[model samples]
Target: MPKLKVKKSAKKRYKLIGEKKFIRRKAFKGHLLEKKSPKQKRNLGNKVVVSYSDTKAIRKMLIC
Candidate 1:
């Protein structure tokens, strides 16, 4: 049988921590920042954990 390879796109976007948890960058930080409030833009700079419902699926893709 062929070895299962982790998805390359997923590998680049998400990171595995310890065993079960994954960390990902927050959304909406990529564009249109000029009109957004400073606080909102600032908050987008932080990383956020993937939600609980998505955790299992993301872990499979991340392979960490």
Candidate 2:
């Protein structure tokens, strides 16, 4: 059988942690930051775990 190729886009955007958990950056921080509150900007800078609904698809892109 041929080896499966990992999705480059997913590889850059999502990170694999341990087994099935994936971490990703929050959006809305890339632009228009001047108007956003400092609290909001600080919160957006953090990495968040991928939602359960999206975990399966992300796993396929990353490992399948």
Best by lDDT: 2
State in Å the error of residue 56, model 2: 0.8
- lDDT tens digits by residue: candidate 1, 1-64: 9878898998888887766678899989999999999999999999887777888898777554
Each candidate: what lDDT?
A: 0.84, 0.92
- Scanning candidate 2 in windows of ten residues, the lowest lDDT window is 55-64
Q: Show pairs that collide, candidate 2.
A: none
> Residue 43 in model 2: shift from native, Å?
0.4
Model 1 TM-score, 2 decimals: 0.85
Model 1 CA lDDT for position 36? 96
Report the lDDT tens digits of candidate 2 across residue range 1-64. Answer: 9999999999999988887788999999999999999999999999999988999999888784
Among all windows of 10 consecutive residues in model 1, the one with the lowest summed lDDT is 55-64
TM-score of each: 0.85, 0.87
Tell me the TM-score of model 2: 0.87
